[model samples]
Target: MSLRTFKMVIAIVIGGFLIAGIYISVLVVERQGALRQISLYNPAWEAGQAASEFIRLEQRLSELGRPGSTVDRNEVELRYDILVGRAQILTEGRFQGLLERNPEHGATLRELQDRLAAIQPLVGELDRNPAAARQALDILRPLEGKLAQLASAAHNHGAALVQKDQQELVRLHWLFSGIAVSLILIGVVLILLLDRHNRLLTRAHQELHVLAHQDALTGLPNRVVLRERLEQGLAGLRAKGPSLAVAYLDLDHFKDVNDSFGHETGDELLKAVAERLRDCIPVDEGHTKNLISRFGGDEFAILQTGIRRPEESAALAARIVEALRAPFSVNGQEIFIGTSIGIALAQGGVTSSQILKHADMALYHAKADGRGTFRFFEPAMDEQLHARRLLEADLRKAMANGEFELHYQPQINLKANEITGFETLLRWHHPERGPIPPSEFIPVAEDTGLLSTLGEWILEQACREAAGWPRNIHVAVNLSPVQFRSRGLVQSVSRALAVSGLAPERLELEITESVLLQDNEATLSMLHQLRRLGVRIAMDDFGTGYSSLSYLRSFPFDKIKIDQSFVREMSQRADCAAIVQSVASLGANLGMPTVAEGIETEDQLRRIEAAGCTDAQGYYFGRPRPARDLVHTLAALRQPTEVA
Candidate 1:
């Protein structure tokens, strides 16, 4: 049956038991009253007491009748009162009822009462004259035998009443016993039902608690439970010496992995990583020495307690990083991912949020140092992070206030010795901080989701500026990786060309291998689409990234920009010169022009030019200048050749 119905039945049973108990109690009370009345009725003792008192009173009346005897009127009067009291007792209580049961006994009691009433008046007369007391005794003497017979009958009748009361009490006892048994059985069932309900309630509570605290995919503690655990641990160490450390860990290039693979693979990879992290720590019981949690995405946290020293924390962080170094096999393929950890130890008084913030700052610093490493917390990290946040806020507003401008660096042809193109570079002139380098603001732009907007603005402005330049001079603008991946890239490029009325042949888009690393197939497809638009595509920082040669075979790039690292060192290092020569030869054989970037000295330019470099651009040409200033420099350079 349903629980509600069962409860109703139990209630009804209990109510019935209550009613039965009440009925039993009332019956028991009634029986006890009958039993009490029967117990008090000792008909033989009362009748004998009345008869003995009458004989004693008769003896006293005879003494008063003795002639010349010492007259004792007081004794005679006391005996008369005693006899009257006893006679009244025989007529009262159960005795009268017992005597009525037998007609002979009842008639005998009535005749005795009439005889006593006749003697009372004579006794009162004898009290006034002692000689009259004998007359009262003579009247009661004949009825004494009738009174004795009545007493015997009363005694027999009382015995029957007592027997009847005992039988009723016995019946009540059996009925009460049955009711008590039913109540016991009901109580046992109710107790069992209540116990079962309590157990189910406990289990449901445990399940809800698990859902609240655990990560759905990884089965690790989520951020909410992690914070609660940290708070509890910190509270314990507050009064004592704090020997605790908090580590904030994040996977390097996780986004790249997610983009390259699928989200399903990413989720499986996270679960695998969580399991490895647990294995890396010491676990005596089910719980580890450290509480690990998936903070969010590829980010995780480890809350460590009972630390002996700060070095212990650093060692733990190192171990965690090395533990993740081993490749994880996901979907039957080996996927390598690195972990960067930031360690923050308790110093003085540290709250959970502050400790977490410090660890985050240290993690950012670790990334700044380079990924796949760990760093200890320091106060200066907060200051640097705060400055970065301020810069990011201002950078957001810079474009709106027109604080950004394009500087053109001339890319001069080695053979023609005239400016063929100018590479468009972005510069931010903050009103308060002065000029911010692209190195500083470009990463910030990418991180703040401002790259796409900044990229479109750069495209439009560069095209507009280059349109105003000499027709033979082309314009090259660097493209952020985010922009290339965006679906709006083709549309943005088309719009820029349309609005500026710049020839597509004179527009060059520079892309780094970072874009190629994200999704090669998609990146190649996008590059081909852009190539079909009739603009030139140059691979920027060509030799710095993986498979630089393989990428050239994947797409017929218009130009290969030799990385400045190889170009700047070519004059000093033979290896650098050999790399420069090989890249220049490769570009020539592929029917692509090679541009050696960052050429500052005559010797470096000569080395690249000897290596058959077709185009070069660096400080040796000229520093990037404003469009108006570039006109003067180009006019001076073209004085003799005049647009080649």
Candidate 2:
């Protein structure tokens, strides 16, 4: 039962006990009254007494029979009156109720009444003649038997009533016992429940404490604990302790691991890395002065105290790097990952925020310097870091400010001996900086999450620009890997095609092999979706990625653009020539065109044509040009008859 219901039951039990006690008490009082009244009302006692009194009246009559007895006639009348009055009491009230249940008691009472009536005449005559009273005494003798029977019946009925009363009292005793037992059991159950609740509360409080400080996956201290410890170290430095070192560490290419394997394996790898970090902190003679914590994802933090020199922190950083240098075996696969550590040493009353910022800046420098290394915080790094942040912020506003423009580079079809398509290249012309190289801002755009916006703008603008071009010529636009990850990528392409009034067949989306790296299934699905719209899809920079062959087999392509690196070296290197030849033949067999990129010299172009490359693009064709420049270039490159 519920607690409320149990309490109600307990109340009912107690109330029942109280009521039963009251009823038993009242019954006991009535039983006692019954016992006392039995002396007067019981036919047994009264009948015996009346018989003795009648016998005495007979003697009194005998005295009247003798000469000069002197027993008054009024005294004889009083004796008869006493015997009859006791008999009348049995016929009334409680005695009457008891006798009604038993017919023998009533019958005996009636017999005695008849005998008393018969004697009444004899006793009355005694007052008339004293000598006649002797004969009246004889009439009373026969009444003894009837009086005895009345006494016996009264005794049995009274005993029976008393026995019934005793049974009722016993029943009340059992009921009170049952209620008391139930109440005790309820109290015991309540106590047990309360104890269990208290234990659960205590355990939950302890778990909450652990959750506050510890990481669920790694069992290491989390960001909250790291912050507290870092602040404590800063406070210690202010109070005349050794200079402290706050190090920020991040795993390099951790996302690649997650994309390659599932998240479960990734989580196991994180735990493994956490264990290594914990083990990397060395035990010192004068008590350990390091606190390692997870700063979320693949980033971790360390607060190192008692650092006498910069070399100590460097050595610690090296240890962390070396420890993680070995490949971690997760899910039966060996995966190699690197750590970039940035240690910011105490600099004259350094606060926690300052150290955290400096350490993070230093980490960025370490990653920029090529990961798997550590960098210490330098005074001048702040200026460069601030500039990077400002540049990223400006790049975000580039799309809104209309600073982005697309330049087209011609794709030469060696077999047709004419320009087939112009690959759309994005160029950002800053209002203040004049012009910025795409290499400089593209990474920033990607890192700042502006790639999606810039990519969409490039798609729509390229389609719009390509709309007015000769219908025979197709426009090729590079789609970033980040853009393909968007759920609305196919819709965005459709909208661009719809708005620009460009035919899907005239717009070609160029995707590098890197786009297929993260999720092959999703990438293939998106490729199929674009193809369904009647648009052409080409795997650009084909041999650049590790799994170029696998990606080729995974999805059929409209065209394969060989990476420029192989094309630039194809004349000098036989392996490069063979690779280009093999790729061209492979594309022919697959019924897809092969486009060789970075063909600058005539010898390179002639050699690629001999090697069966159907199309080529590089500085030889022309550098990427603006739409105005491309309009004249396209008119000049068209067939002589069309030009006339």
Candidate 3:
């Protein structure tokens, strides 16, 4: 019940009790009044005492009438006085009312008073005159029956009053009994109401506790409960013989799911994943020591307790990985997803936070290695993660400090044997570490969500620098997958071209196949928007991804750059050469320029040019140089080649 309703019931119960008590008090007071009236004045007892006194006085007078009697005159006078008092009592107060109500009783009372008055003087002179005693007896003897009749009448009236009083007493008794019953019923109702209120409070408290410690979406233990369980397990690790394993599980590409589908569908998919995770562990019989919790979003944590070895945790992780591999049907769509797990074994001297951190680091490595896999936490991973965090922190500062610069690598047209354009490459120079390789800091920038900002800076800077170059040469800039995910990507590109006053056709934006892997419609739409800007688009690092050929069909491109790995091994590996030639032939047929990257020698260049490659960009032609040196490099490249 609501608090207001509960309070109202209590108020009603108290009011009932108060009303019952008040009525009971009134009944008790009335009963007491009736009892006091009946006990204080009893007409039947008064009449009997008066009659006995009359008899005693008569006998004493008879003794005085005898010759030489032993009866004392003073005693006879005392009897006379006592009889007078009794007659007075019978005619007063309640008795008077009783007698006056009956004509016969009233007349008898008058006659008795007259008789007593007439014998008052005769009693004292009884010893002196025997005739006086004889006269008294004659006067009193006629009134005996009258006195008896008066007594009988008083007795009948008293009996009637007692009967009426008895009825009133019975009524009072029933009234008191009824009030008592009412009080008991009220007490019962109050008890029942109070019990129900308590039960409601208890249920509300339980629900609050659940809401505090349980995940609302998945109904799993939340992070708060997870931390508690992990702490408890860690504390008992030394006392118990078995080991503890904390596994950090993250749904791979879960953000993509949320983006592609709606958040509601993503929520359903998370619930399904939680169910699958629960099914993967053994929790029946005596195996109740394990705990699985949702750490919010697409992240979950599992605690395996009382395990014999690390292998058990590994097996559990493997089971979870396998269980999640199956397609989940959410909102009538079969969505295929995967998980990356990181496991940390608990030992002496390790805190819960440390273990969880280690597990998270391992999870990062799992995702880095590729999703749908698991990895055990290693000491080396901690160092690596620490370094990565430091790098990410420094990367942010580097962007603000203007410590990065760009170099231009020339893309050669084999037919013209001249420089066509320079690919814009980013180079970072940290204050403390000097030059940091792109391989090391690029992933950190992407993971740290700084790539979009950095990519914008690169695009504007490259366009600004290329605007000063010869009007015939264009500039190519590489686009990270992270940049395409940004809603402002097309705007950033347009802003760059507008600010630099560079020709749209002279700005080439290069992207890898990974950019098309996310939100196909959005990606294609963004690509079309960029295409409408009159800028050239090239597929960079072509043939590096599984869906590169499909991506080529998905979007038309101005050029295709053959990945360096294939070009590097083309001479040694015939298949590599054949694959490069096939891509070149395909590009030619589609009227798209194909640039072979990483060409270092004449033999590699000759092979690519003869195999229908239109362009080449490698160290053999020119290494990437800064814009200051690029002017001279371009001037040197424009020089005609001398025949041997």
Q: Point out the higher-scoring one by TM-score: 2 or 3.
A: 3
CA lDDT of each candidate? 0.82, 0.80, 0.86
Residue 613 miss distance in model 1 (angstroms): 0.4
Q: Which stretches of candidate 1 lie over 4 Å from their true place?
A: 1-340, 344-381, 632-644
What digit string (tens of lDDT, one per residue) describes model 1 on residues 1-644?
56687678768867876887788788778767866766556766788787777778778888785878664777877887887787677778767666666778777767777877887777777757765776777787887787777666666666767787788878877777877787788788778867876776788799899889988888888999878978887777755454678899999988988998889899999999999988887542222267889977999998887764455567678888998988999998789999999888776678899999999999998999988999979863365468778988998899999999999888988887878999998888888889988867887788789989999999999999889887999999998889977778988999999999999999999999888898899889988989899999999998888888789889999999999999987767899899989999998899999999998889888888999999999877677877766753445854554332
Per-candidate TM-score against the hidden true structure: 0.46, 0.45, 0.56
RMSD (Cα, Å) of model 1: 30.1
TM accuracy, model 3: 0.56
Q: Which stretches of candidate 2 lie over 4 Å from their true place?
A: 1-340, 343-380, 632-644
Least accurate 10 contiguous residues by lDDT in model 1: 281-290
Which candidate ranks first by lDDT, i.e. highest?
3
User: How much lDDT does candidate 3 score?
Assistant: 0.86
lDDT of 2 at 627: 79
Question: How far in Å is the alpha carbon of 559 misplaced in model 3?
Answer: 78
Error of 3 at 509 (Å): 73
